[model samples]
Target: MDRTVEHYERIAATYNEHWTYNPDYVRGFSHAITDALRLTASDAIADIGCGTGLYTRRLYEDVRPTRPILCVDPVRAMLDQIPASPGLQPLLAEAEDLASGRVALPDGGPLDAILLKESIHHMPDRRATFDGLAGLLSGHGRVLIVMLPKSIQHPLFAEAHERFEQLQPDPTEIADMVAAAGLRSSVSYRTFHAAVERERYVHMLESRYMSVLGEFSEDELRAGIDQFRHSYRDTPLLRFDDHFAFVKGWVPAR
Candidate 1:
């Protein structure tokens, strides 16, 4: 139980509303999770921190349903947002809450996929969390953790980037944490579509993640976002480059 997840538990309800689902974004990111899992019948996959089923619904549409897909999140409010679908099993459980042996499968086996999308940073104990995940995986199970880089490399985000730098995890540190979990895995990255749009991107940032921006004083937040906008005010929408990298890997087969 890390403080990160606890923080998410507090904001889970409004999180999804802030980041409206861009199907194109979901498809681009989820491709790796699906490709790594190589889903087929007889396989069960769980989307950890499956908030509002954004990616879950995307997976439901894109991937071939070989087995039941379980959507797991600690907050019930987030779980309640997931609309039911064929073979979609939405469960209310935090990352550390999966030890319940009662979780079942159609073939009475274990899970084949576990996706920790942008959720690992919030966790306090990475090793303990992954260790628990290892026990839940079937022989071929893989865990894919998707995340953004710690640094805001763009000039428009100078102030916000400064704060992000204070809170974000280092790549090497995160890699070391994963290795300490005693799992066999590899990491990869992909840039997001935001890599292209600066002004609209900043606007989206101001509108969508206001809570995150609001964490600072109103004057500071406004000054930061306003200055961020000014940095890109002359920048064209499509000309602005914003790429978010997702680090993905898997636990080797048992």
Candidate 2:
């Protein structure tokens, strides 16, 4: 398994803990996508790289309660956390496998939507992956790729922000990739706030809650945490601007 998958498998148990700090962040994103797609209870959806079913559960509960949804991820441990439900199906697979027909829709039909919620950055090849996934969409199916651009005006911390900027794909590049895959594409932005106590935020940082933070050495992680604590010493209720780029692509019915 790749380092990314291994890292997530190791942290699968605590992955859902993110909701505690920013309860509405993921749900807000889900609502935006569902609204943009005009999804209904009958629409078939897939949540790619759905770590611990964070957005998966929210999409089911808040948006499409009876929709057939597949939660796809490479790590079994992560998939193991998803609660069993009639409409929710958890599959162990990677993004590249989707295009190969290795990953199938829950109802054995074409999908109406595929969601890559903060998960595209982890894919090995963005262009090829998008091209492959586009083929799996139904005549009117859509794909929504959500990410945070490096140019975000504000992030949780300077170091983490810089790392995100370096790792995330450019919005234009993502749009081009989707368009190249023969789907009509557009990009939009959304902003949410991650509210947490300063002490809790520091603890999350120290634990390397995000995969991006895993790149830092122990010393670097410690230094970053110290800087954050020092910077927000006076702010008890710490709120950070969480900016996201939503890239939507769709093929018109034949």
Candidate 3:
């Protein structure tokens, strides 16, 4: 197994631990999804790839009581950490497993809104993943995909995409896959701001990024990560408003 993948799998527990408790990231992400989808009281939503249920609690708050929301992820450790709620249910499944019919809702229904926040890039096959998502959609279901574009050129974005490209997928490729999934899709561009002191932004970038750099012994990678960290440490708080985009689509009713 690739050490990076194994590392992520092992750190899944840690990711859950930190992310689930972070309110700022969760609220911002949920608001992004809700805004993009124009979520209504009648919507039955499923947050696909809901790691650690970071945004699931927000989903519970933002979505209406009349609508049932399902949280799905393949990582049990991540899902298990989430406390249960009245309308919230967690399914242990991958993005490609959405249509596997492994998870059944109490009401025997399909999803009206599906949120793929920051998780779409992890799928081995974007096209297959969309197909699975389409299969699980209710007639009026909309799938909202939050993607961080590759050309952003920020150090963290660039480093992440360099490794991601080796996996052979890009946001544009995902948009194309969404079209091919036989859904009507459109994209909205938006920005997310990080409110941090200049030094805090640097620390945030370095501390989080170094974890990934540990995988490589290449002096260039090491140097690049460090240089990026130094250049941004006192520069300014990162706006992150550039790399964010969302694609919303609907599966035709059967």
Pick by lDDT: which candidate is best?
A: 2
Off by over 4 Å in 2: 65-67, 153-155
- The global C-alpha lDDT for each of the candidates, from Candidate 1 onward, is 0.63, 0.80, 0.66
Index of the highest-TM-score prediction? 2
TM-score of each: 0.78, 0.92, 0.77
Candidate 2 vs 3: which has more TM-score? 2
TM value for model 2: 0.92
Tens-digit per-residue lDDT, 203-253, candidate 2: 677667778888888898888887877888899877667778888999965
Tens-digit lDDT string for candidate 3 (95-202): 665555555554676777888887776676677667877877787778888876655534463555476445434666677788888898777777755444555544
Off by over 4 Å in 3: 1-5, 13-25, 102-107, 153-161, 164-168, 197-225, 236-242, 252-254
lDDT of 1 by residue, 193-225 (tens): 544456555555654342245456657756877
Pairs that clash in candidate 3:
191-241
Q: In model 1, which runs have C-alpha deviations exceeding 4 angstroms?
A: 1-22, 99-109, 154-156, 195-203, 207-214, 236-254
